[model samples]
Target: MATIREIRRRIRSIQSTAKITRAMEMIAASKMRRAQERDIASRPYADLMRQVLAGLAAQRQGDDDIHPLLVQRPVNRIILIHITPDRGLCGGLNANVNRMAVSFVLEQSVPVTIVAVGRKGRDFMVRYGREVRAEFTHLGDRPSVVDILPIARVVTDDYSAGLADGVYLCYAEFVTTMTQRPVIWRLLPVEPATIEARLEVGYIYEPSAASVLAELLPRFVEMQLYHAILESIASEQSARMVAMRAATDNANELIEDLT
Candidate 1:
């Protein structure tokens, strides 16, 4: 048995909550659009860069002078660069990505260390008792290459120095407004796709193919990391927008029922 005054107060509280969620939905929508645009825009460049690296790798497939980054070695230890959102409220995006990483770590025979890129991933890894090599956070919605350079450096340096024999990157990839796929990509021992002889065009390198590849390998890693972050950001915003919209709808439904 509820009085009119109590019902009115509860309704007011729910309405206020609805207003907040509606505002969040709008904000997330705006961020989602921008994030999607940036993610899409970077794909072309990333693909082109991958093509060029593949061409270079194809040219020096069996050469002993191949870039260090392209050198494959026995698996000793594994490093996973796990990327997730800093905050929650994004449906199951964070959980999905974290679960994927956990599964990956469990499946691996070698000892796995994490390079956590966001607060959520870092906290999850720490709680799970995983050895976190490095933690990077506070990368806003619009992070540039400069912001991601340090992370790239850690992965590249560790791999080059033989600190880790294998490296992987895990992130939530933006597929659609309603879908975010958690994907794990091998980042070390750069496996470039072989190009057909007929498909390869003859182009002169600035100094030598080896020199160009040596310089390009690091840049390629940096670009891949930056692009992955962009995808994760887009996924985060999209999930948040959807989740907030749902929350607002639920609040409105509750308001109607109470009235």
Candidate 2:
């Protein structure tokens, strides 16, 4: 059994840890608010872009020309786009995402190549994934498309080149401060339904609908990825903030009991 001195030492260690966590929590909380505002602010532009793309896609169905991204390819090899935190200490955020990604891999029959976007995802896929094609790391806080563009382009390029038949992006979709759910979103061979829902507006194409789609499709994919990264960063901050607050509360409770 540990003596009172040892217990005191342990408490002091945890106290120090709690202090650090509390500071981190405050920093993350401030960043989270900013991220939330940015996300909300960007929604209108994103939605409008989606609507425009959808209309373009719908109009192209009747035309002879169609964008390559909309063309369905035979199932052969697959690309799994995985996203996770660069650091730890935020409950099971990374673990749960990893679990879902693993489950997805296990269910797949075709050969898969992983394109990991974070250290946690990269490490987990390296250990577990059947095949890891590429790994990216060191994505700092407050990421942008420029940071994630190269990775996204690689995945899309492989799909376009017939190297990968399809692409599935996996990430933790933030639902609430207390809830984040793992999601496997299809990225390649863009879903028609997804386009149809937003094609409410009509437009007159300058060159052609197909030409417009060809240019817009890749940008859409890249922007979507950027959005996901921003969301995950915000979710990480929120989760960390909550976790730290709990730790501080527990420490306070222990101090009260001791006194």
Candidate 3:
């Protein structure tokens, strides 16, 4: 058993840690509000893009005119767009994502290139000396589309150029203030079911169907990357907030027990 003085000393250390965590929690909470707002605002555009793609796909199905984005090819080289936090103290958010990535790599028998976004992913990849093709960071406080555009372009270009057979994104999808689930989402060969689901609602396409699809396809892919970045950042903050809150609460409980 530890003495009261020892307990007090431990408590003091925990208090200091709690202070940092609390600050991080406050910061994460503030950013979460902005992120959630941006996500909500972008929903309409995503919906619209999906609808337009579905309509175009339907129109072209009769002619057997398929876009390059809709074709499935022989699997060989794959690229993973990994999203993690720039900073630490966010619990196992990064670790969980990395675990899923490891599983992804294990399940498939092909060469993989990683486009690691954020410090956590980059740092983790460096240890294994894996092929991390690109890295983006310093965007956690407030990530913008422009911040992620280069990486998105590279991945899309690789797929289009046949450098990579498929592209997948690993991210933590934001559920609520306290819950985030790691997920792997397909980025290339856009899922037909997604288009079909969106097409259930009627939408009028501007210009010709082929023309609209030609434009929307690329943008849709870019937006998927952008949206994943936003979701991951938001999820990071929420996880930090919840983790810090738990630490703070535990500290208070210890103090109560001591008194």
Top candidate, metric lDDT: 1
Give candidate 2 regions above 4 Å deviation. Answer: 1-14, 62-64, 196-202
lDDT of 2 by residue, 200-256 (tens): 445778787777778888988887887787788778878888888888888877866
- The regions of model 1 sitting more than 4 angstroms off are 194-200
Sort the predicted structures by lDDT, highest score first: 1, 3, 2
- 166 Cα displacement, candidate 3 (Å): 0.8
Clashing pairs in 1: none
For candidate 1, the 10 contiguous residues with the lowest summed lDDT are 193-202
TM-score of each: 0.95, 0.90, 0.87
User: Candidate 1 residues 10-53, lDDT tens each?
Assistant: 99999999999999999988998898788678877777767777
Candidate 2, residue 127: Cα displacement in angstroms equals 1.5
lDDT of each: 0.90, 0.81, 0.83
Q: Candidate 2 has what TM-score?
A: 0.90
Clashes of each: 0, 0, 0
Instruction: Judge candidate 2 at residue 63 and give its lDDT.
Output: 58
